[model samples]
Target: MKKDNANASLQARKEAATPRGVGVMAPFFVARAENSELWDVEGRRFIDFAGGIAVLNTGHRHPRVVEAVRAQLDAFTHTAYQIVPYESYVALAERLNQLVPGPHPKKTTFFSTGAEAVENAVKIARYATGRGGVIAFTGAFHGRTMMGMALTGKVVPYKTGFGPFPGEVFHVPFPMPLHGVRVEDSLKALQYLFKADIDPKRVAAIIIEPVQGEGGFYVAPPELMRELRKVCDEHGILLIADEIQTGFGRTGKWFAMEHHDVAPDLMTMAKSLAGGFPLSAVTGRADVMDAPAPGGLGGTYAGSPMAIAAAHAVLDVMKEEKLVERANRLGGELRERLLALKARVPQMAEVRGLGAMLAVEFCKPGSDTPDPDFTQKVRARAMDRGLMLLTCGVYGNVIRFLFPLTIPDAHFAEALSILEASFAE
Candidate 1:
């Protein structure tokens, strides 16, 4: 691959080989990445605010994570945990069981993606409670799998032409004060769901993202979470927190659920769990996890040894670097900058999120209508200036900031400046 032809040739080949359904956000292909920076094949450097779609919260190729994966590769990679189990897998599970926000006796299971963890969590919930229905909030993005797509709330790209999704899965409104859907409105919708849709007795679980990930970084109000807990307890429904994007130090905590006093019955985690390696987990009450028989769960590469090793190293890196505190500090700085920009850029309607998992929403000036066109222009302008940004939300008017918690101070400032310039453009 010659320097001049690097990106163009590769992109042409990719178009020929890959299906269009698999979206490509960036036109340039990555040659390498370290911490919060990426180098394209053409050698153009980019400050990565997308963070590989929130999967590199510890940053790309953290020394500890790389060292751990290298060591695991030297020994072995996969053993199929259900067939030939490894100690590291069990150790990782134990660590998660202890760290996840519940005092009740808990157990953990590993998978390969956030969607897998969600599907397994739903399976476990149904098996434990012997129910056929599950509930999810509007504006949630579980994954692309059948169950995940069914649970996801957005329609255009995620659910368009992809359904007939799974049956017995329902969606209720999520609280969005900016959009006029208040906590009371969301709670009342749940009540209406029980009355007009599925019976409470037949509903097994209610899954929600602590901060809406793909739906624009709308933080779930703590009060709404407490109310959900109360409702779940009242109806004997299991509450599952989909923390795939909000876990690790992205939200200044090990998990977003820690932000609230209430703890969920089951939690799905992934994305940053194994750094860049693929890994996901579902942790919950011991009794509930045990509801499925020994042969009833697991996949071919459910707990790959390399990913387990990476996950252990990720935990160590979080503690040693104090990335949780860094998330809080960085998030505050970023929010302050965005708020200042919002004052000048009338399209900047809101800046909201928890910790470092922040987002900026754009709307038409003097109106609440979403300004997706302006949002895309900002993203494109930022990319042209070597800053990679990601857009989300059902309206496509949000620019989410998922820069690594380990991002250097200098790079953070540079990225912020680039963002401001993009908005100005």
Candidate 2:
């Protein structure tokens, strides 16, 4: 084969010129991706464990999603819902209202990203309650926008030097079994916040990720959720479930909060909502969502026709293929396999998660010290063997599994074998 021209290696050249802020995950260039795998421009195949950061629950380029996007492409790309409303956007909303938890009449508004969905949820909640303060958790990652940075709790890369965020955003401890943040401790933190930080009544909403996706895959304990629900009801504050990373059957249930049997007044969903397309939504009680007056919420690209079409297709595929059920089956096996591996690798520490949204937390043996270096080594080794995985958690010592539920069993088994061998090496 002859050497290719620089024009043919645009991605590599572009990386050299771009600022480091434009962070890249895997170094390989994607010539194409399908189901649970990626093919690099050099034609190397990789088992995809990142799943586009949990935004490809149905997998990359699912046939149905592709056909839907292609069809929409022929019809038209954008007309701007605000300029002229489209049926698909409304149709998608109707589906979310029915799919999301709760018996209350629900309404939904679409945005282009998870951050936008979360930010708008806060806006709707504040407008509804006429309050300025809101609360989040210590390990939470709401987004990178100014208000999102304010809501996000981690300080290092996400918050460091990016302070002077929007005011009145409070933080409390998020519960994790491995860390022993019990329900009582989380509840008391809320109580203490009322006493020391801000009045509960002054707060409009308490936003949280049902499963802290970026904060290390800690499933919020059911008891903690029930307590949060009670306190929110008592204080007349809305419970805003941030399902940006856990919705669309990433968790065993349709929504992670479904496991708790409590209802949130407001919900923000994105990520897999559009099967890798840019689409997100804030869905909740009709009256609460209506708090934002006309013209209060919307963006130029909100609910683009292509994304709405893909979203509708994503919902259809989830039900048609029973991906929610698939998540439970796969997640159970993943957890069990991890437990079996734990008997061997002391670095594994603890394995926990719900549905397909699972993680293995690494800590120093017989100690609580976070083992970020071990986690980093595992990821580096995994990458060398053609497995693309991601590490998360405030401590940066967790390896999360976000493979598409639609991945073939053979591929999944192969990936697991690769992981086991990586550990052995």
RMSD per prediction, one decimal? 0.8, 1.7
lDDT of 1: 0.93
By TM-score, the best candidate is: 1
Candidate 1 residue-wise lDDT, 1-425, digit = tens: 79988999999999999999999999999989999999999999999999889999899999999999999999987779988999999999999999999889999999999999999999999999999899998999999999999999999899999879889999989888888999899989999999999999999999999999999988899999999999899989999999999999898888999999999999999999999999999999998999998888899989789999999999999999999999999999999999988777999998899989899999999878999999999999999999999999999999999999999999999999999999976
For model 2, residues 109-174, the per-residue Cα lDDT tens digits are 999999999889999999999999999999999999999999997887888887799999999999
Lowest-scoring 10 consecutive residues by lDDT in candidate 2? 1-10
- Supply candidate 1's per-residue lDDT for 392: 98
Give the lowest summed-lDDT range of ten residues in model 1. 76-85
